[model samples]
Target: MEVEKMLHMKGGNEDTSYSKNSLLQRKVISMTECIIKEAITDIYCATNCPKTIVMADLGCSSGPNTLLVSNAFINIINEISLKMGHESLEIQIYLNDLPGNDFNTIFLSLPKFVKNLRKDLCMSNPSPPSCYFNGLPGSFYKRLFPSKSIHFVHSSYSLMWLSQVPHIQETNKGNIYMSTTSPPSVIKAYHQQFKSDFSMFLKCRANEIVSGGRMVLTILGRRNEDPCSKECCYIWELLAMALNDMVIEGLIEEKKMDSFNIPQYTPCSKEVKDEVEKEGSFTINCLEVSEVNWDANTDNRLNLPDKNGGYNVAKCMRAVAEPLLASHFGESIIEEVFIRYRKIITERMSKEKTQFINVTVSMTRKA
Candidate 1:
């Protein structure tokens, strides 16, 4: 489905924009805060204290969370510098995302971020470390920086998206992603895609990151080794059910549904570790999986009397998937589709809650 051109989150600050519906992603970031801190500390300890530190956040989609991790690293580095009596350190921070991402939102919000950063640093040190910020637009699957330029790299809730659909499966007629009903051929295609993409990712980073550089990645993944495990694919399964209902109602054509497939894959922990080991450039320092409820970020206490659990979930999904679906099915059917989606999720939640398995890994570039 030309993922590089169409797989971005909804842009702008509207109701369905990723900026408004990324609470779940923010929660994932919060959950991984300790890992991030530890990675930064390890970087400080392993590398010679260079006067300038360079860092990049891959897939820094537009939202509060875009800078959340970067801000944390800056603060941590500042504290470390002050304690080590190196207050003059400078930091260059790069925020990266796909070309189709809403970079303007992040650009507009940068002044305030810089202001707050300066204010926070001034509270302790009279002369705060200088931080330079730049926005890089491109795919991380390829090279994005000069060799040995980056000291740290971070990505969250991304990397699950493949560069493109692995292969078209006419046999998997009713599904848009991997599901229990999908054929073994479909599963094999997805695994091969991830293996190639992840290997390229590590190779590119190996050239860009300095020796002893660290990277911490947190992505939606599966705990079970099976690629079609329910925990990894149920969200798409419910989404497919919603689309099938639309097809029956004559709102969407069956042929169009047959052609659409989500360009995403959730790998198991073993798969991630295997790729890292095979890439021959990075050592896996730590790998852990955490579980989060599907509705972990939904704020039920909000005074919105009309919002139901299903509706909230629908909003979150719409914020991320609307662009991709609209590209395929046309925009006219989005609202109706999500209405049905909300109903499906609501009924399902009435019986049981669903959860996402999150994989967090820390690695260091080999000397």
Candidate 2:
């Protein structure tokens, strides 16, 4: 454990994973939240807000993903309102995330989206539901919504990352990842952190989810006995190796690298079970964890250094690998890194389609 700490102290990139709401993202997240829609359909029938109701998408990143969320909510609301014979009551939606999120980008795109959507509904000869959209900012782990004030909440992909890093220099004595070199200790520290963070999330959420409110969460996860192995995804391990080789070449020092960490969040099932079971305020409606196939079309574009691809693969991960690369690679080297990253990831995928897993939990608040 101590040896690992010294190596991390030498400097390296701590994180370099990209998150774009891709086709794969849609399949995984939507599947995860499908159950939440079922519960919310009933709730929406009971109270069309203005009479009493609202919904929120926590950590809603700026992009088509936001639209995906909104559309899903719309379908649920439409169905419920139609059933209750109260289609005129406007449903207000709050798109929320940390203030650092690109919410402006999301909002900027929304007006056109609404117009287009209205046009579509008109063509179908259906009365379009009325609604209002607003952006709210806050760390969901802290205070997200007012006390007992939300009817439904949805957050995807974002819950797996903590609001900030949670490791100490001393006890963080292992593989730039684990708190200790021993597999058990590393897993323990990770579980401990997950237990704390998730419980905090539940407590805050408890305040927001009215007596019978609902929530849907989708998180990155893994399967297999060696789920924690560095090689779970060759692309990630290769990136680390590429950066590690640079360290040996005297390109970057180690201390600058270890300074960053992958903000801790529950990585697997055990920790999630611990927190949710302990909270007892939510009833799990669905818990499905499986690997999603990752076969992005890198055929002709394998070695191509695309900018968005670079951002997706690593630039977003600058915080994780800041110690490893910043001193040596130019900020502009994002392209070069993409060149190498693309080559390796494509090779791995072509060899055998790589798969990444997600753990989804759809729960309803206890009344």
TM-score of each: 0.96, 0.78
Model 2 spans with C-alpha error above 4 angstroms = 1-21, 46-52, 121-127, 169-186, 224-235, 264-266, 296-333
The RMSD of every model to the true structure, in order and in angstroms, is 2.4, 6.8
Q: Residue 114 lDDT in model 1?
A: 95
* Ten contiguous residues with the weakest lDDT in model 1: 298-307
* lDDT, candidate 1, 1-367, per-residue tens: 7888898889898887888888888888998888899999889878988889999999999988899988999999988888888868999999999999999999999999999999999998776789999999999999999999999999999999898898755557899998888888888898899999999999999999999999999879999998999999998999999999889899999999988888889998999999999889999999999976677544434522223667767888898899999999999999998988988988887776577899999999999
Looking at candidate 2, what is the lDDT of residue 224? 41
Indicate which candidate wins on lDDT.
1
The C-alpha lDDT values of all candidates are 0.89, 0.60
Candidate 1 global CA lDDT score: 0.89
Which residue pairs in model 1 clash with each other? none
TM-score of 2: 0.78
